[model samples]
Target: MSDPNPSPEAFRQMASEYIEVANRQGQDAYVGAVATAMLHAGARYAAFVAASNSPNKTQMQLSRKTNLDQITAQFRTYLEGHYDEHSENYDSYIKR
Candidate 1:
C-alpha cells in the first residue's frame, strides 16, 4: 500500500505550484479574488473526492460532517501557522 502519510516536501511542491499559478495571473487580478477562487476550487475538489470514495450518496452524506470537520481543522492549523509566521515578520512582509 502507499504511505498513509506523505512527506512535507510533497506538500511544499504542490503549494509552490498553486502559488505559481496565482502569480502568473498578473496584476490585473486582485490577490484577494484569486485567493477566493483557489479556496472555492479546493472545496469543490474536496467534495468530489469524498463523493468519489463513497459507495453511495447516502454514505457520502453520512460522512459529510466528519469530513468537513477534519478539513476545517486542517485548514485552521495551516492558517494559524502562516499567520504566526507573517506576524513574526510583519514589517518585512508588509514592505513586500
Candidate 2:
C-alpha cells in the first residue's frame, strides 16, 4: 500500500479489525490476524525507514522481520519488531 493511501484512520482501522477478529475468533483467530497485522506493520516500518533515508533497507527489513523482544536485548527495541507490537506476527514471541 502507498503511504498516501494509508491514512492514520486506515491504520487504526486495520489494527482495530485485527483485534476485533481475534476477540471474536479467540485463539483460533490469532494466526490470520497476526500475519495480516505484521505485513501491515512491516510496510509502515519500511516506510519509516525509507522516509528517514535509511542507508540500509536490508537491515531495516531484517529489523522489521525479527521478533522485537527476541532482539530487544540484542538490538534497540521498537514496535513492529515484536508479535504483540505486530499482532499479525503470530509465530514471533510476543513480549509479556
Candidate 3:
C-alpha cells in the first residue's frame, strides 16, 4: 500500500490513537511501539533531508544511501546498548 502523507493534525490524531492502543497493551508494549515509531520516523526524516537538499539525482542517491546506512547503524547501536545501565529509561536511547 502507498504511504499516507498525513497533515500535521492528522498525524497527531493518529499518534493519539496509536498511543491509546499501545497503552491498552501495557507499558512495555507502549514503549516498544514508540521505539518502533521513532525508528521509522528517523528513517523518514533522513529520506526527506536527502531528497530535499541534494543538488542532483546522483547526489540524492548518494545522500540517501549514506543516510540509510548511518541511521541503521545508529538504530542497531541503540538497540544493543539500550538495556545497559539505563534499562529504566527509553528516553536515553531516543536521545541518542
lDDT digits (tens) for residues 1-96 of candidate 2 = 458568878988977986686566556656777667766776677567454654576765665545344434433443436534666765464545
Ordering by TM-score: 1, 3, 2
Q: Per-residue lDDT for 1-96 in model 1, tens only?
A: 666566999878889999899877746798889889999999999889788879999999999999999888989999999999999999998865
- Name the better of 1 and 2 by TM-score: 1
Native-vs-model 2 lDDT?
Answer: 0.60
Best by TM-score: 1
Each candidate's TM vs. the true structure? 0.86, 0.29, 0.45
Tens-digit lDDT track of model 3 for 5-79: 988898889768855865665565567767677667767876786677678888877676677787678778857
Worst 10 residues of 3 by lDDT: 21-30
Give the number of the best model, judged by lDDT. Answer: 1
Candidate 3's C-alpha runs over 4 A off are 1-29, 87-96
CA lDDT of each prediction against the hidden true structure: 0.88, 0.60, 0.71
Where model 2 places Cα greater than 4 Å from the true spot, the runs are 27-96
Report residue 63 deviation for candidate 2 (angstroms): 6.6
Q: Which TM-score value belongs to model 2?
A: 0.29
